[model samples]
Target: MTFSHDGLRDSLTMLAAPPYFYENLRRELATAERNRSRFTLIRFQLFPRDEQASLASEESQYELAILSFAEVLKTSVRAEDLCARLGRFEFTVILKAPSAVAESLTSRVVTSWSSHQEWSKTALCKSAIVTAKIGESSLEILNRLDNQELIGITQS
Candidate 1:
């Protein structure tokens, strides 16, 4: 019944960092390959659009927004969904759903942030939702999402 420190750490939460995200993503892709099911990859970028706030304050504000947003995401999605903090201003969610469902979820998230007072201060939030393609590598999907060239729901 004993567990190592790493085991305890691994058991903590579904949310993951870049390294773990990449590893888990690889496994998830493999599972999708075997099951012949698709998953949606959604990326969220939260930032403050106000120029009045100093860079330091803006960063701190964004940090708070990120935390709040992460909580919302964790609560909103199903337990099987994977969430990750990809960077300081970026987050990725892996959902076992179609792109339409992912789009609906993305829209809901953006709308929820608008009404949430804490997220109001961090005005600019954007989300891109795309379905995982068959025979596509995890890196390719992540790289595509990272491009930010894809149009997504954005609220100021």
Candidate 2:
């Protein structure tokens, strides 16, 4: 991927925010150089089912659910990966591995979630993976098994 002088200049001249953004970007670029073939976007979700009204009354259940999800994330990926907290009920993970890696991560995530749910006396978790774009970056071949709502984890 050859970058013409002008294109390279434009990318490098990002107005200016702070040195931190550039430093962080440089670090990410260095890491990308080491493993460039794969990138994944994992949407970790924790949707409380409306049907599970029993869980509604149990604040501790929600706490357990959050803790369980934290366990899954902590156990699921490498130390260098990025995990974004998108919402109270969701997370987005970015990994250095390829698309197949993402698909496998999804499976591991769901499997681990299922095991945790079983321990918590709840139903299995639902999950999905999808392709995301970051301009010239490459993409991976992944099977996105999201929820009925396409947020991962199906519910009635």
Candidate 3:
């Protein structure tokens, strides 16, 4: 199921919140199906890969890490692309490029975040990049990502 933000913005990442993310996903799916073009939907999740997970302040640190990661995302993609906070620790990026470009973009983003001192000190961020399949719906894609399964063709 999806959620509604109404007037509330995603305070941390400053990206479009859940409901809007679903809306954009729907539109992108339709456009991809119509044009028979390839696009990518990437899911990023920030989780502690080390002892940081034992900290009581891990939640706030995750927020800060995500905020910094969002900045990385904004700089990595074109202005026309969409980035949204689909859940507390999950973000989704819509890339209008082909599979190769999308994979490159994802790799670039991962590299950028990995090089950042703050993120490196905070948590390990995992990402999955996948292409949108023809006739696939937005909800199905999201469900697949939530389950850690590749929805369309797995590009990563």
Residue-wise lDDT of candidate 3 within 8-56, one digit each (tens)? 3576667878777777789989998999987888887776657635423
Candidate 3: regions farther than 4 A off: 1-8, 51-56, 147-156
Query: What TM-score does candidate 3 get on C-alpha atoms?
Result: 0.82
Shift in Å, residue 148, candidate 2: 10
- How large is the C-alpha RMSD of every model relative to the true structure? 5.4, 12.0, 4.9
Query: All candidates' TM-scores?
Result: 0.80, 0.58, 0.82
Q: Considering summed lDDT, which 10 consecutive residues are worst modelled in model 3?
A: 147-156
Instruction: Write the candidate numbers in order of decreasing lDDT.
Output: 3, 1, 2
Alpha carbon lDDT at 81, candidate 1: 82
- Residue-level lDDT tens digits of model 1 in 1-156: 111123212222335667777877888889888889999999987655677864246455655666677777787788888787766656788899999998888888777777687675555667877788778899888887877554445455
List per-prediction Cα lDDT, in the order shown: 0.71, 0.51, 0.74
Question: What's model 2's overall lDDT?
Answer: 0.51
